[model samples]
Target: MTSPATPTGSTVPTGAESADAIVVGAGHNGLVAANLLADAGWEVLVLEATESPGGAVRSAQVTAPGYLSDLYSSFYPLGYASPVLAGLDLDRYGLHWTNSPDVLAHLLPDGRAAVINRDLDTTAASLEKFAPGDGDRWRHAYADWREVSGPMLETITRPFPPVRGGVELLRRLRVGGALRLARRLVVPVRKLGDELFEGEGGPALLAGCALHTDLSPEEAGSGVYGWLLAMLGQEVGWPVPVGGAQKITDALVARLTERGGRILYGARVDRVLTARGRAMGVRTAGGGLWRARRAVLADVPAPALFLDLVGPDALPPRLVEDLAHFKWDGSTLKVDWALSAPVPWTNREVATAGTVHLGADLNGLTSYAGALARGEVPRDPFLLVGQMSVADPSHSPPGTESLWSYTHLPFRPNWRAEDLTGHVERMEEVLEAAAPGFRSLIVGRHVAGPADLENGDPSLVGGALGGGTAAAYQQLFLRPVPGLGRPDTPVDRLYLASASAHPGGGVHGAPGANAARAALARDRALTGGLYAGVIGAAHRAVYR
Candidate 1:
């Protein structure tokens, strides 16, 4: 671990360092790894290329100075449900979230809207209004979810060499708990919804919620994706940080440092340095070499870490081929709007709800997903708009509201700078369809196309927020490619501790925590004393 030394300036340089563990990036995963290792009495150093630590967990006045917008993920049910973070005690570090009563409201193309409230009974009751028996189905689904989500999260998300969750799941299958869950897993959300519910917009609306994270309800992996989102909505209600998403990162940073770790911003690590197939350390962009005496946990992308940093010669042939065949989700176009006032929704329910899902129904979601497969962008897009100032007033000055919305571009927009006006204009037209006169609400707007996101952060990979695709083919055991699902990379002592690993994305520190445990185990057994002595001397050298 190479922490910042020399109070004002750094001797164990940001781009260059020599420590026990040299972490490459300062994204949430990178930060999480640094915090965990530091707590374990290891010398840990973190390097972030961005000005801020959070990769997508940023809240800035992107549109106008006063209107604070959550840059990437806005509503976070996953953040609240994260076991890694739940263990961190971050409230003392300055992270607090406020949840509105109604978690989401989907304004249908027709004037009607389906509002999902925090209370399951109320949400079920609301569904009953849509259809007499749909309410019971909703409750039944939640009960089923309560059963499997634990097992699913355990097997899919637990730390490395994960056997317990897998063993338990296999045991359940042997007994018969797997039949219904297996059926749910195989059937697409479209099929699942058809069998379960009777409603005009309620089923489709719930599917829309599932589609929020860029999943297609028609796809195979999408059944679990859809059910989990719906279940979590009823179980935990979507939450946004009280101030902004940055508060979450701030809280994490505080706890990490308080645990005797060090953080450095504007530090860029170029490559993972290895000696005889074992991970040693890293080389920074500025030509400084930081060698790790024990382990190196990398928070960079898989391709960047494997191909660019460690080099192809160091990896197995099958792994290289898999990396080549590894798929990335299509590019995205995100827009942050600084509204002069609240957006006027046609269905008034969304005017107060935390999130608004606007787009076509189940069929439309499949069409959009299919369109991306054909490399065509959707004219009528699926948009999720989050009203920050609606639930939290401090996001903007008194009375005014802050709204940020996003829709994927499916095919990367290959247009010039002058062409952005057309893209933003098209996005506004899509918004105006659900929220009448949405153009009038726009006081200031900031546009970030696929290139902009990649420019801002390269790991975003065409601005696909979940690292790569969250589809069935690229999820769980197959994430970032098969066989190396847990955070361990091809290089010894170097772990891929990012969203690209299993149980992917959404501000959860599972990947980081998983990687840290792996590193800690490795560090404690064979190289613990050697790394401690070297890194401790490195820290004390500058301190004296």
Candidate 2:
């Protein structure tokens, strides 16, 4: 195991034959895993297929030179809240976060908006304008969330090895916290929010937050996401980097390198070169064999890694079947707007907002979901709009604004070029209905369909951003399939360190942290506990 010369950006060809560990993708998660391993003396070498390190973590001047757009994951409430990320010391590596006063503003049909101010009193005061007591409901959920969320986050984000984390979480969280967490996690977001608030905008707020991952409010497991995000927003508030999302990645890359980790950007790993039941290394797509003596980690999704990259002979038969049944999260189509000015809102108040939601109502969100299920792009799609210029001034030239808005469509759409164009049109219509003349604000716009997402990185996998679906059926240990807790697939030491694994998605490093913990724990003989066996059996079954 050796730490070789620092390999530069995404174009460095790999001629090296061996390293301490060879990670297959330089996604933020892959880089995070490599850094953690390197910090523990693993001599990590990350090989990315792309010409750059940031996978979905990239920001580009895709539309114009002076304006930058975050390609994916613009608002990072979840990323900011993850405990695993807290320990990484990202701020020390040059990444900084700025919190806006009003975190979210959801526009309605009547030109009225539900604005969530960072201060609870301010948010409640605003809610009071919509209806009475809705303010109190906001207060209750926020206060309740403050009590039990810490342990709940730990259980959800910690490693799945033999399921030890769950047991430990229950042990650490008091009886009341455990009960509250259980009751909160099981209900539907629609039901939960409706039960709590008595205002015109309460359900709309819940629906908007829940749909961040494009999950309908009525969907199973919607409660967890909706509550976590909304409550977290009330707690820490949502923050973004000063320039764009790229600052987060740049900080991560700097810290990883500063900690003695080696990164190679352009060398794409074609396969994990394995022998027998043990892990060996990765061979770059261009015929360079970069072998890892300790472990071969893949930041790739489960399907691509197991079915496409590793041959069928490498996996168990049951896992082969599960791979076919694995559900992928819906694909994302993005539109970047380089605006001459802010989006012109009919209400005028939303123009200066940090983040705005565009849709009709809760019905509009439901309509969007129903249409997607029928393979039709929603006639009234709910779009998450980020006015980056409002959040951070450096995104554009003075008086100009950089805006990004995105929405989810079904994984397989009967899309011609018009289907995508039509979707964008519908998005504009919804925005226009909420904020009159939104279309007129567009100075330049760049559209990315599934093809464009694939062009950016094959890892988006048909533009499914979270690697796979975030629905209840695919979550937890069932994620990417049931069996293996480690990112390692049934194919020996090959691990799935992407967002598709347990503790799924977002810009958080939990999946990568989980994988690295598993790799190192194996070496340290630390995962031999009994709870681990159950977690292992579950992992093996899903992957089998």
Candidate 3:
């Protein structure tokens, strides 16, 4: 399985057999890291186990020939706003985006809907219908978002212990406002809603966004995610790739290949080969070894990288113990449909929105998340729906529509096919209640349960979407582990470049960008030493 090495440590020239850096898994982040390194003149090689790249950010026409459904992810607000992608100008590489007139809608039990529009005033006015004076509260909250949005996003995406982001936030908010913002960050979404507005729409909208992760509306630190994502919709509309989600990944792969980087499909990395406690390269499942002269960036989940590939024996005992406590997020059940007609919503506002949240108000949302936390399947599950045709007409034939909906479930170590079918039926009933005769329009359908998703992409371990739980104990500095939140690993030349790392999931390439910056810095001996020392000191301070 090993490649021939010369006396001078040169490769035997097996065509992409050697590179300055090797990226495992051709996910968006992996490809992003590869492109960055290749742009820097490093001979980068990317390995993908599947027949294609784009681990989760891919599309399929499972329902019908003309229907393009985003198999995993669809919206790209984060991708559009990503600083790394912005610098790359992926538009030139064929990543055109399309946005709906309205961003999202939260449909209530009574058929009224709360719509989030790109215009702040319009969104505020919509909230006014639920309660008097709520429009002002909405505007006030948006003003706070304006103050901290830049700094908050920078802190999330940048390297850990964001000193620069802290300074900028403090400068913008001043001491009092900054302190208030800090307090809000720790409050539960439920409490945040109560403090801000006295209306169902205000609270329901926030809770709906919080459910995007595995967190309950009552969980501490859930408010931040809810606020952040909702504000992102305001700042940058939840845009979809013109053709499909695959366009984003396709563009990334194109840029990488154009920069002379190579991608090897069907190369499943079986193990990460190490020498003297440093990553050397990877061995594929097909008994072929590729060498990396500088670094190996693993864009797979942390458990897959550490437990399965690297093995517990190779990790420090403390890290191995910590890995045991690693918590996965909730499992998912997704249903994609090729409809003969658009969803006939009871509320007209719902028809205009690209995304919809169904079968939940504030209390229901909390209860649904709480049920998952208690390892129980929710009787009335919360649904996240994507109207592909409404967002971008290219998703299906004219007048026809492509739609998908998904809901979270507690992790069942051994989920069965019958269980998924039952859940799908329950979801159908929920949708039918909201949109009468909804099921009649379905010309074709495809269902992906937890096992199906995991089989398709192991990164969604047990179908936990955000790489892991976004609970207070498992987010930010403690994400993946209690280690410093950078991509650098205890193993030299090995970096964690997956969504399982800091900032945890979404289409943002921050984890990959952070890993590449670390590797790039390491290539410079003096800068590497200094950066390593600083990171080590920070790690000690936190862990001590």
Candidate 4:
């Protein structure tokens, strides 16, 4: 690695390019943390291993020139609705939203489709097409969402255990109401659909959303993920940043630079420097040492932070043992295309949708999910199709469409390179069934398997999108190997600020925002002591 000369700026302090904080990765979450810290008058230095930041949020013309495809994450309902992102005022920095007429459509085998729109009544009417009385159930669930979604989103997006949100939700729902809500939250998406609606349409819609996470429809705690995304789709239409996903990173980088923060691209931090059991600085692959006066936040996977950077020798024995059992979501295969024309969906309604979900039905989704869990690829795969041009005309050249689709594969697939080709072919076959002559519309195509995805973004370990599995046992307080369930790591002055942190994965910048608050609190002696005492007590109560 080549160690280049350190640059200069007022934000760059005297010794070793020092700053108030040193962020190890320049993913969206890392940028979010840096921006927040700099806004508070702290000198921040963000280091990225890649030549550019944005991690998986960046977009490119992989298929052909002028065909912009989001490299990884595409839809961002969470980004639109996230309170943390909202506070950042990204729009002022040149981020624009492009929304489709409908948020999402799930096409079924019977030629019927379930569609969700921003308008509640319209979405309800769509559900009515599936079953007569299911529309009423849809409205009832949304009515409940109106009462609790704010607190629920606040709770998940904030710190763990969500004490305040829990209390506020309890107050709104009452004791009996809260118990009922808990039941709904704990069950599998399949069970939730059965309990709430009698129609296949409503349940299928929910089950399709659950696939967005690694969780299968039958898994506990998946119902919440399904409920939240579907609710948010209805509340805030899924949107993409105008121009491309890169615009989001461009806006964030601009905001950070304006606030006097510096980002060092091509600086790969190899290890976290520690003195007296506290993080002091980072030693880069390029042999550069950057010190931090206050904190070091890592926007990387938990295993990378602990296993690679911190090392097992420095961590508590229990935590290290837990690391061995840490699970990963299934690997994924994604395909992007520069289409000669828009996808001609067999279902006319699906043609107008921003996102189209195709699984024969609930059974098809469940079967594919089960196949992944069993270390096998499914004969028939579930497809999540995004019509980028339909959502935003600027995504492609005039009259052309930029389209993409992805399907999950077994995390540890015992396969060959040829197997990946078969998977891609299978994915196309599945799509073709839904949209006849889809392959004929493609002018150019690109595919990324698990290896390609991980090579592109280290945080997407084993191609797990959420940074880790979203199973009930590993979520909430147990996330990223338990302990306090907050940003603070076992090592003082080092914080975990990535999708591996609380609130799991999404475009939402909660992990970064939450870590920033923790770091700021620690920087202030008053809040630091109080937070430490509480977190220490929480660790003793839970882990000890």
Candidate 5:
């Protein structure tokens, strides 16, 4: 197979093509995998179903021609802190991060705001307003987080079983301290907050962070996520690319192309071509057969990779049955607005934040989440709002704002077109309650529900962000259905490189990095065959 240059100057396969690795999906994870493989001198090819890259990490002028709105994810604390992304040195490829004066603001029902600032003293002071000594408690919690943050991040980002990282964590915290921390992490966010905070401010901040996932404040293990994100914000302010989220994608693509990796857009992979229980290549919907000599990495959801692409016949019966129970996170409904002016918040502190959590107090969040779990939409939805222009001024014209807010919805809601419109109106009302005259400032508005999001990026799988549920039952080794908790799948030479893998969700790029490392490890001259033999045996034992 010969490579030919496309009109856009990217190399594409002229006929049947073979590469050392074929990555299905041009999402950030897939692109990360391609970049790593290309850096190792492999002929890497990425096939994307859409016309562009960056799946959910994309931005566009959806509201208006001049205004830039993040089509999906906006703020990126994980991207800034991720060792995997840092290793890529994306800034060298024109990625610049920008942050607002504050990291986040959670506006209470009474118009009091709990804001998180980069400065410890300022954040503590903000919390102190609610309860006298709550500030000191926050300080103590933050200090504890700092002690274990290094090893904790390493453990979470690295492949599961986290041997080296786990050992390092034990060394850092000691046995008793580690067990205590584990106990805290296992409880519900509500309980964790109640135990740690005397006032509503601290608990509100933590609960708001927990809502980022599908888990409600009452769910066990929600505390860990909430605490992790809150700590990350204090450590590294939630930031956006200077221009837009697309800049992050552009940086990855630039680095990959520089390394001679090729990405073919509009190539929807229809099947994982396997023979003798080994994945050898992929067939696209357009009838293009691309072969992979070393590996095929899928930056797609577990169900799509296993059931749709690989087919049930090729999968073990147990594996197939487990997939039937694979749970997706809540569907999302997002609204983007081109505002004529910045939001006129009741509390000035809310204006300083790049991100805001609105329409919820601590208990409100619980009720909203409960509604979703019961397959019903909350009348007063809890919103995760982004002020893109506040984070990056280039997102909109001077004095104006590129704003977006998203709320969780039931996985399958029986709603008509009018019902969705009514939800949008309700969202606007909630915004208006927090930021008076907010609706008046909107110059344009665009709404994206589950179907629309799925159309834009099939990997989103019904607008369910984070790839899959972040529930305790589906996390860690149980992710994408148990087994080795690594990238290796039941099919040989295939890897799951999406958020469906371990260390689920957030834009950390760990899953992609892990997959790349696995592929490279199994392709090494001396240890390659040995590594493959062991991994293959483990899969056979588990899947059998």
Candidate 6:
């Protein structure tokens, strides 16, 4: 098996290489696509611009030695629930998952909290503490979710239009039922919470989950994301890799290599070489060319893929114009700490939770979101905090905590060092309010601002974590631009296999799996021509 490339300053071979398919960017999505294509017996070559794989799904001793912290994403409820990831059977490749005692907890100014435990009754009881009968409401909501979750998840993760999954969903929840569900999904999270629960506990839980995306509680369709994630956590506890986030990437790389796939690191693709309107291969910044016999799957952001790599001149005029209006999610600021001891939360239950949402109640959350929308740095920022050592003991030394928290910021062209430091202090203030003397426990700390995040991974453009905005206007069939919501781009033999495509972001590999499936379907000898003809015509109509 081939070893992974060095983490920095790796040499680029100066020669033209050829493979059955060239997958650009070695992010989890790109890796997932490569692994699937390799399983189909096609020789795959992955070109990563960075020194290593995993993009944001990486880990390092950022705060202090022996304190391993996930550089970007930490929790993975989606990863656990994702059929695509589960189908890969990563367990055989040394990937193990572990969860904290509780899935998540949302802390309030009053020191009260709403917690979700692996046990449904425990979660319901926690909500019931807020108000009488709220527990039953939560149970009912979960039951409803359970009835639709199977088909709902399938319809979500499958290729857009989700024909088979849609049919099953329709059969289960008739025409009127489907219409009602759709209406509910489009409602604002605040409204959905009010409709579903009487107490602050349930609503607070939903609102906290919704903030996980860029969407605020009042935004339309935000409730769907809130409900989806919350229910997924209930079904499958928010688990983390036993060691670090890197294990997930290592597992994908191991599986790909086992199937005879190759990955070239530090290979920054400068251009996607197209011949007669069809993608042929790519040329790296080092003046090396790699040709693909069949297809090229790009796991980069939409703007980078279309404007920078492919060039606007090569794309349809309409597509280029549409891209100019692409909306990025809010930028982010993250802080990591190697603590002398665990955060002494006012609510002891929060310490048992892997993820904690602090610095906001419903009204506080609304104000914080509003501040971000108006391009103002929030004084009371909502913090999504992770206690890494609690989730996976291997992340830090005994009795110590590897902790992190990130909050969204408005997009800015640049951030001075002082500006980042100031924001980091603000974030710490939020944490300190929830856990008094939180600052005293820090042994070391590292801060990553918006620019730092983008520099580390181009896909996280402007530090927008979900690839692009998950707003209603830019989702489903309209994601990355209006089209069939499939992976097929205007260019033939090229697919958008990143979170920029339909279904947006998360640790789930749906976008990559969808792209791989599209490539395979169009390469089949029997119906390949027909599939290409239909998809190509659709692209023409959309771009015309």
TM-score of decoy 6: 0.96
Candidate 5 lDDT over 1-544, as tens digits, reads 1111211111234366899999999999998989999989999999999999999999899998799989999999888888889999999999999899999999998999998999999999999999999899989999999998888888888998998878987888899988988887788999989988898999999999999999999999999988988988999999889989999899999999999999999999978887788888888886688888999999999888887888777778888888878899988899999999999998999998999998989989989998999998799999899988888899999999999999998885234678789899999999998888998999999999988988898988778998899999998889989778899998888999999999899888999989999999988999988998999888888878
- Cα TM-score per model: 0.90, 0.91, 0.95, 0.95, 0.96, 0.96
Superposed model 6: Cα runs more than 4 Å off? 1-15
TM-score-superior candidate, 2 or 4:
4
Candidate 2 — number of clashing residue pairs? 23
Q: How much is the lDDT of residue 484 in candidate 3?
A: 82
TM-score of 3: 0.95
Task: State which candidate, 1 or 3, has the greater lDDT.
Answer: 3
The parts of candidate 2 lying over 4 Å away from their true place are 1-16, 161-177, 484-488, 525-544
Quantify all predictions' global Cα lDDT against the true fold: 0.74, 0.76, 0.86, 0.86, 0.89, 0.89
| Local lDDT at 235 for model 6 | 89
Q: Which digits, one per residue and each the tens of the lDDT, describe model 1 over residues 17-84?
A: 56778787888888888888888888887877777788878778888888888877778787788777
Better of 4 and 5 by lDDT: 5
lDDT of 6 by residue, 337-413 (tens): 99999998878989999999988999998998899899888988899999999999999999999999999988776
Clashing pairs in 1: 1-20, 1-21, 1-43, 1-44, 2-45, 17-290
Model 3 lDDT tens row, 155-212:
8788888889899999998999889989988899999989988889988888888889
- Model 2 gets an lDDT of 0.76
Off-target runs (Cα >4 Å) in candidate 4 are 1-15, 413-415, 533-544
Better candidate by TM-score, 1 or 3: 3
For candidate 4, give the lDDT.
0.86
Q: 3 or 5: which has the higher TM-score?
A: 5
